[model samples]
Target: MRKLFSYVLSLCLLVGLFAFNGGTAEAATGLTIKDLAGRTVTFDRTPKRVVVLSPGDLHTLQALGVQVVGRPTSATPVDASLQSVPQVGNIHQPNFEKIVSLQPDVVIAGTSFLGHIQKAQSLGLKVVITSGSSVNDIKSSITLLGKLFNKAQKAKVLVGKIDSKVKKYSKTKTKVRAVILFGSGASSLVALPTSFSGDVLAKAGGENIAASFSQLKDYPGYANLSTERIIASNPDVIFIITHANHAETKKAMIKLMSTSSWRNLKAVKNKNVIFLPSELFAASPGVKITNALDHMNKELLKVRAKMKK
Candidate 1:
């Protein structure tokens, strides 16, 4: 009777061990996600060594606490904290030789770098392509990164903050017509669609002049418009996003507008021109978007006050 009882006890222990191991394996399974460029990627496991090809990817990876073994030269100064990381050239054109030397397990890239995707795969490197130029794209990238790094909880928290800020700022009752001038002058004006800057402007309780134009399925960049077009639009407020060193360039553009025949347009006549930090508007999500939103909020308040008077 004692021998039979011992045999039963050993059998139960073996079953429990198998169940535990199976559960662990399931938990460690790598995830499969779609990139912005419409590529399906699968990670065998959490990536320990990563190479980031874009500033946005770098920023997102850092937020997720992933170790970036390689980055682009433009990413130099490496977030101060990551200054020790090696440079692998710029995302527009990456040095595959240097990237291979780094032996990165995974490479994170943007839609612009889709051309190199096949080469990366041929070298036996895993790659993820991120899509969209809007805030929604940012959110998706964050969640995808979270899944890749097994940091889904952290991604949720960060996204929640962004969503909350957008919701709160969007509640302003007053609405004003606004234009986002990328080049600082009336002649070089390009309208940002609701898909890109529209949601940010809307969050600030301002209307984008581009909204008045025909609805475009995709966001347009560096749109060229004639002086006559500017006059016809007649926007109430103008927001300029230019390079930091190009403040004078913006001023020059503004001066040129003043000399134009339509200098009397409402925005110019009232000096409603507002210049924003160039880097903040650069295409990446996260705190940068928050910074842009804050600047927009302040500018909108100024426009609101002026309109009330």
Candidate 2:
């Protein structure tokens, strides 16, 4: 009777061990997700080696506490921990050879590089595409990446922070007419409601003057609004997002504002022109969006207060 009991107990232990291992194996190989390009990607396991082809993706991964093997080349400062990571190239022109040599398990890209996606895929690199064009898109990217990296809790926290800020600022009773310009002066493109910065302005209770302009053919989210139309709108605030050096851009903008044609504009006359920080508003901003929202909201509030006075 003792020998028979021992045999049964050993058999049960073996079965339990097998069951546990099986479940783990299934989980290791069962991940499947869809990219912004409408393609389904399957992973054998959680990615251990990742290469980010855009600055925004790099920022997203960093926020999730995921270390990357390679990052896109940029003039902007990166986290201190990632300073040593290999640069695979910029957003529009990635260094394919270096990326292939890195042998990354996956590469995260943005929607602007659709043409390069297939090229990277052909080289046997799995590319996941994301967009950072709108506030919703930023939140969605954070959520999606959290799932991919198994950091759902952290993503939730970050997204919740953004939601709280939006809710708080969206309640502003003052409605200010505003215009977001990419670059400066006549060469600048006006942001439409469909753009990221424009979306933020709208969310903060500011009316986008360029919303009614016809979208540009090449860039649907921006338009070439004439100086005459801009003056006609007489926006309460003019938010300038610079692509070049901030001081230089501001100087050029000041020069333009002093011109007889633009000097009489309401925003110029009232000193309501604000040059947004390039780090927050120039790019997608990734996890730093909360700071951007706060800055814009505070500036708008000051404008409101001045209006009342």
Candidate 3:
């Protein structure tokens, strides 16, 4: 009887040990993210100090409630909560010394700055690069950051919001023919279906007239369509996206559209020419992509309503 009792006690302890080990192993599972660039990075533990180098990425982290130690500089103000956060630098020109001083556990950079990735890695900083040039890219960035920061549920909610917005607008077809131009005057480049802004416009019910045109060799998402081609398309709505001098660009655009050939276009005759904000349309709006889509959809709906009259 004594021998049996001892054996039973030993068996119970072994089972308890196994249970504890299992729990630990389960808890030790780390997060691994594959960014838009097809590069993978793993996080064994939640990052406490992160530095985001792009406004789009910064916006995503803000939505996920992941605070950053450093943020990028933008012409417009960032989140009010992050106003006091140190500005390391922007995507084009990052201040590496300042970034290193921040001692971030990870640095989230954009794919536009490939050199930054190598420099950061050389400095022994864990880095992951992402892209937001497309709507899907925006969603992927949110999802990637969510997993990295242990905010997967929040990420899911944000992505669901975008999906819901897309679904809401998809049911109603506006039948609006539109053109999205990077600039208005001689430097204009038309956005293609492959571009992010083009995808947003398409999702919002506007048929991108430039979709069929050949994309630029260097930039597959945009094309340098001639004035004749644009006129032939005869888009019902013309949206201009300019990087600087909004007033000047608008003036030049108006002048260009007022020309004999341009004036004959349907959009010009109907006064449907519009200018989109660069901050919102030129770059990936991240969590605000839904807002961008809503704006476009509402505009298209207005156009449709007027057509009925």
Candidate 4:
């Protein structure tokens, strides 16, 4: 009888232990998701230490209130809030040593780093490769990041605000023919509508001049156009992005346009030259893009004012 009782007690204890282990496994918080490249990445828990390899990813992480443990050197001084984040190295040639030192649980990269995904994995680092070509891509990236950080609610709110802002601008039917020029001279000219900048312009009520050009490539955001082609396009509003100070770049661009056949274009003749901060217009979806839209809107309103005269 005593032996039978002991055996029953042992069986009950084993069952209880198994149930407890199962519950612990189920309670573990980290979830796994597939990235754009169809690679499965697991998050043991909300990534506390994250390394952002792309500027767009950096901006998204910053917006999510996640501390970026590492970033590339090309990252500019962001808002005062993110000034303290440390740089790991250039994204093109990431400093693996530095990255390991940071001990980031998740490394955020872009399509540009698809080849290096294995290197990250070999180092026991989980990676997420994001693709940001259009505004939709940016929205999707925000959603993925939200899930990774367990901040789905915050991501939804941020994306909603972005959508609302975009909707507010989209309601206007004012389609101004605009050209996005980076740098000076004819060779430096790049036609938009094939780039992320084009998406932003289109969303903000500007009709990109290169959208109809059959020869333009689909991506990289610009078409090499000759002065003749630019003059032929004859855009109504000329928006130039420059690294130089706003006032100086504006003067230089106006001078450059006067020297070219652009003087004959409607935009030049009407004096519709507007200069925007180059960095703000460069890349990614963030407050900079929103601010750029506001600037563009104000400039477009002036153009409207002139047209009414």
**lDDT of predicted model 3:** 0.84
Q: Model 2 clash pairs?
A: none
lDDT of 4 by residue, 75-168 (tens): 3566675666677765568888888889988888877677787787899878887766667777778888887776778889877877887889
Instruction: Score residue 231 of candidate 3 by CA lDDT.
Output: 86
Please list all clashing residue pairs in model 4, or write none if there are none: 195-221
Stretches off by above 4 angstroms in model 3 are: 1-30
The alpha-carbon lDDT assigned to residue 249 of candidate 4 equals 61
Candidate maximizing TM-score: 2
Model 4 TM-score relative to the real fold: 0.79
Off by over 4 Å in 1: 1-28, 75-78, 183-189, 214-222, 243-248
Q: What is the C-alpha local distance difference test score of candidate 4?
A: 0.72
Candidate 3 residues 77-145, lDDT tens each? 766788899998877798999999999988988877776677778898888887877888888888888
**Model 1 Cα displacement at 199 (Å)?**
2.8
List, residue by residue over 132-241, the lDDT tens digit for candidate 2.
88888889888888877778899999899889988987887458888888886678889999988888887777888887898988886899957888988988888998
At residue 196, give the lDDT of candidate 2: 85
Per-residue error for 241 in candidate 3, Å, reads 1.1
Worst 10 residues of 4 by lDDT: 21-30
- Order the numbered candidates by TM-score, best leading: 2, 3, 1, 4
Candidate 1 — what's its lDDT?
A: 0.71
